[model samples]
Target: MSDWEPKIVSFLCNWCSYGAADLAGVGRMQYPSNIRVIRIPCTGRMDPKFALTALREGADAVWVSG
Candidate 1:
């Protein structure tokens, strides 16, 4: 079988969580490479439809950080 990596869709708040993610990148933190981040102005502005769409589009998981 072919190697498979989980596809994760992450919704991050522009204020804090996004910055944390940036730090993780700058620090060279080890994490699955399958995660894809989407920055939003705020968690309050997040819509359920976005997660649904990500799932429908074949994302193995969806995460939100704020």
Candidate 2:
């Protein structure tokens, strides 16, 4: 059987969370490829419709980073 990777959408703040994610990549941290990153100015900038759209688009998980 083929291994299935779970899909995860991560919304990170441009100031800190995005930096952390970049560090994770630069540090060669091990993680599933299914995770997708979206950088935003801030967590409060997120609109409910965006999350709804993500869910409608078939994302297995949505992560909001502050």
State which candidate has the highest lDDT. 1
Q: What's the TM-score of every candidate structure?
A: 0.88, 0.83
> All models: lDDT?
0.92, 0.87
State which candidate has the highest TM-score.
Answer: 1
Candidate 2 global lDDT:
0.87
Write one digit per residue (lDDT tens) for candidate 1, span 4-38: 88899999999989999899989999977888999
Off by over 4 Å in 2: none
Cα lDDT, model 2, residue 21: 80
RMSD of each: 1.3, 1.7
